[model samples]
Target: MDFYQTDPTLENYWRGVILFGRNVASYKFALAHALYEVDKSGSDLVTLEDLAVPFSRHLCQHLLHAPKQITSRGSQYLETCVQFNNGEITQDKLIETTVRLGFSNVIDAFHNVNAGEIEKRFFLDERKTAKGIRLTDNFFQLSERPQYQNLVYETNARWNLVEQAWAMGVSRNLVTVEFDEQEQLLFSHINARRVNITSCRDSLNGYQKGRCFYCFRTISLIPGDSELADVDHFIPWMARNEVNNINGVWNLVLACQCCNRGEAGKFAHLPSRKLLQRLHARNEYFVQSKLPLHETIVNQTGNQTTQRKDFLEKNWQAAKNNRLFHTWEPKAEGEATF
Candidate 1:
């Protein structure tokens, strides 16, 4: 997230930032309104995603420019759509049609129009190429399941093009672990951390299914917040507990806000503590981010406590070595990974 934090006053310096996403939100809202109109007018023919294209192009324009927009050149309707929408379109439309049509019934008509109509009406006389088609197809695949993990991963993979820097962003918004000299292994009790018990049940269940691993009480992402659902160490921080060897990951397990707090400082589940050790030793080390929530830290590999200092390290070199981001989704029958 901090990767592009240049001075906000850098004089349209944001011209180069990859932030068409912000404008896309507006376009999506416009599309939604259009869809609502279509439904009310007895024409539920077009779907929400179809209405998203024109505004998506409009989004590309804010970021890329007119000549560079994805629809600049094309042989087919969808292919033409991609020509102007692919991440390269610049904010060149001195005056965007869609922007002018803000909150208008025509925009609603755009939202209600199907891809076939739009393409046939606006994208005639274009040569559709496989390259452009693939690009457009990729976007749809991603919108299907916008898992933050999958999005972040694919973004790093395709966009990184060089050094993968996922560890930082992950910690900033998703999941992370820390260790630093300034804070000599400072640990907090499982109770110290605050969380929304009713979190993102959708994402949590997607990861942990039913039944809490700790209490087996059908845990879920505490609803409301989008924070990581960490498998915590229920015992004291700094690994102080020794009875039943409670400091390990095996003792740790899935815990909701009530269980984590209701028994804060107090021992809850043996598995909660042990699970961290096991998960830690497994390939579950939290990758610290480059964006500084705190100081510098590295992601732990499967084993670090047993290894010699400096020899064991935590860096995103392997995970992000030559990162790539792909919007993953099942293809229509047999599409290949681009």
Candidate 2:
């Protein structure tokens, strides 16, 4: 329940994990075993809080046999929490209570963390709780209210890209530019707004409401809220080798920041037009149906995928010739009608 703050050295280590992998799921997958295993002299574990409930560091101590600092802090705290100079097994003894009690709360915490959108919903500072994420309370609470169920269902149907944009905005979002070795501090020569990237995103948002055309996560909540809507390339920029082609409007979607930064670029170079067409067609079908959109995706995925593919193919040559994913626009929502 109580803890020491992360010192500079350990703070850098955690930041490296955050910056490099760009998501907590990637970080957790990377940190699994070292977190639990015993070491010869000491372990690399440290106590921290669960995300929303930051004050509850020991909330999940049941998982750690003997939860203590893994990284270095000061001298006194280490002696009491870690190796006993007397060679007693207090370290192992404390952690054992969890294993002995049959409480799965601790391990389940780890699993819930790795479960996608569940992790990105809030801050993960451990002085809070050793737990790493915030659950979708707003999303769920809104969903349960019949008045908002339709909106919530539609929102959750496209949650992945939605969450991704929110994550990019909340975390480290990179702006791309062609720079010479002399260009330092990035902002010196970078015309971020003039790049007209926002205009591109706006165009898409003009159509899709700044929500991701793919997933519905809002893309611009975090600090500095770097253009949550990004100009995406339907084709890989590297593959095309043409700058003009890279920023074309036809090639773009005003998707949530997550789709722009994380999803589209990671697994595929650009999102398939077929996917968009499917998303659109499916959305239209859901709107007409008596059932919620979430249920629609679940029930009609196979058919939607096929029709979507067919629709995209019919427009395939035109979309490719026009270069569809090259630009982006902000999302439009509520009464702030753009």
Candidate 3:
């Protein structure tokens, strides 16, 4: 069975990640797109060498841009490949990293390789016709899944929006400005991250199947409902300086207005262990979504699951240490049974 179809919470978790998360190199999204395209003929088999051509082209066009003239170093790994565009790195290195990084990222994000410390025998799996691995049955099914398609669309759309916003801001900058104009432009785009909450809610509500992220209560998206939806910073926006990109999709969750503004809601408090588990499970669903969010989270936190959990735990401790404590009290009637 497609778990996303059966599990509303899992599905919503993915939507939250794809729509709201900050992406770096977009390896996860690129890999999925390539697989979906090559498998469009309905074959479960795919060639890594063949995939590299299209995947490389897509990343180069969309992601492998020059380092920011001032602020960002571009994506950490991809920037190494940017030297290829500037005639600095060898084509062989470019091709090698393209295939290796893409393959590793897909496996890392989806296979939970680090969880088991597997030997990566799967990457070397090959067939007579092509030097490539077969798609996992789970992934093969996901290639044809509509939810997966939505994930790709949302991930690319968000990247395009941020890129365009940055480009627009840069294009309008004046040479006379004394401040790092490009940095200013980048921050301007970053600031727009806050606006994504409302813009993404319509689709997020559908992905969440109209349930609040915290309380799991049925939330109203219908016109003129008294109990409207609210976009909550799951980690609380008040911790912005302490947490990186607090407004990004990873930290944002849909909540009922009550849970958002209630005395106990997000008032600089870390959630209970149960809620933290829900958040972790939700993030795991994002990995299964086979989109950039998976790689994004892995990159943001550590590569290992324990590391990611520890990272969240540290953030929670930081909140408590700073005295930002507000206990989340799920209402008896407000919580969903699931």
Candidate 4:
């Protein structure tokens, strides 16, 4: 099935970009936020200065992956701003670099629109000359359409989630992977700390009805049972050494020790399609609960239900493509109690 059937807004937004944008990194989301801000101010006009804060804020929120991780010197420009001084690169220097790069991406987007990249008339009503610019009627209708309310809701919802997560010092970080030049095989793992996932279990346990995420068996709370719980990284934690924060509730799930560590357990493997489906349903419960975790998931995956499913599917595919999709063996030995 096409993605639009499951998540119309997200699908449409992506479609808009594929049609109108230059494919610059994260430009779609950045552009979405920019449209939201201008619309909120009851204006269709936006200047370079008007976009600076939003663009900077969006770039600063996530640990971006360029050719390398954010900490790497040659990584994305915004990531550089988040780092401190180290000789030629300082926070101030990075900030200036980001501003220039961000403006360039925006200009490129406009150029794409003007060059008839979009099938519709224009992305902006007023042509962008040397000064500022105004958005087109088509742009507003696309952004503000009633059927697409989730687009705006999801955008703001994610921003709020990120703000809260950052305040609490929780990060949705990525691990970097390196490949050998000749063999084109992954290099050895780099040392990285495990993300603190214990912080989320109590609520997940409650939400899952105390069931293990993979096998659908109840997880025991008691001290000595084999059914005792473990917080598992749905996507194996070891696959990507550079991603340190795979412990977010979006990726963490309650699991029985057997499914977690038994001989047949899935270690660093991508789960079966069934488990992916189950995880998507499970995350929906969190979204329905409207808890802080809900915001986190929406922020990570787009607000639509399908987007979350798509995120897992894509990650699983990536792992498989990299020869990282180890097989998981799920064996059920009737539910045990403490």
TM-score of each: 0.28, 0.24, 0.43, 0.40
Write down the worst ten-residue block by lDDT for model 1: 11-20
Candidates in order have lDDT scores of 0.27, 0.31, 0.52, 0.51
| Candidate 4 or 1, higher TM-score | 4
Give the number of the best model, judged by TM-score. 3
What tens-digit string does per-residue lDDT give for candidate 2 at 1-338?
A: 00001112222122222221222221132122223221223322233221112111222221133232221233333233233334564544434432332122332333331132232221232323532323233323422432231222222222222222232232223322221213211111122342211122222331233345555554442225554455444444543443333333223444555565653332234445545453454334322221222232333322454563443354444444555444332233222211
**Where in model 1 is the C-alpha error above 4 Å?**
1-206, 220-231, 234-254, 263-298, 303-338
What RMSD does model 1 have?
Answer: 17.6
Q: Compared with the true structure, what per-residue lDDT tens digits does model 4 show for residues 1-338?
A: 12122333433433334322333244445656665566444666666566555665555554332222122235455545456322456545554665566555454464343244444432452325633456666666665543243344344333333333333333333222222223312121223532221223343554454467777575654445555677777877765553334555667777887788877787777788777777787677556534246555676666797788888777767666766576674865533211
Q: Please report the TM-score between candidate 2 and the true structure.
A: 0.24
Error of 3 at 202 (Å): 3.7
lDDT of 1: 0.27
What lDDT tens digits, residue by residue, belong to model 3 across residues 118-168?
A: 222223345445657676454444445434544554445445434443443
C-alpha lDDT (0 to 100) for residue 276 of candidate 1: 33
Runs with alpha carbons beyond 4 Å of true place in candidate 4 = 1-199, 223-226, 241-245, 332-338
Q: List the residue pairs that clash in candidate 3.
A: 20-249, 21-249
Q: What is the Cα-based lDDT of residue 242 in candidate 1? A: 30
Write the candidate numbers in order of decreasing lDDT. 3, 4, 2, 1
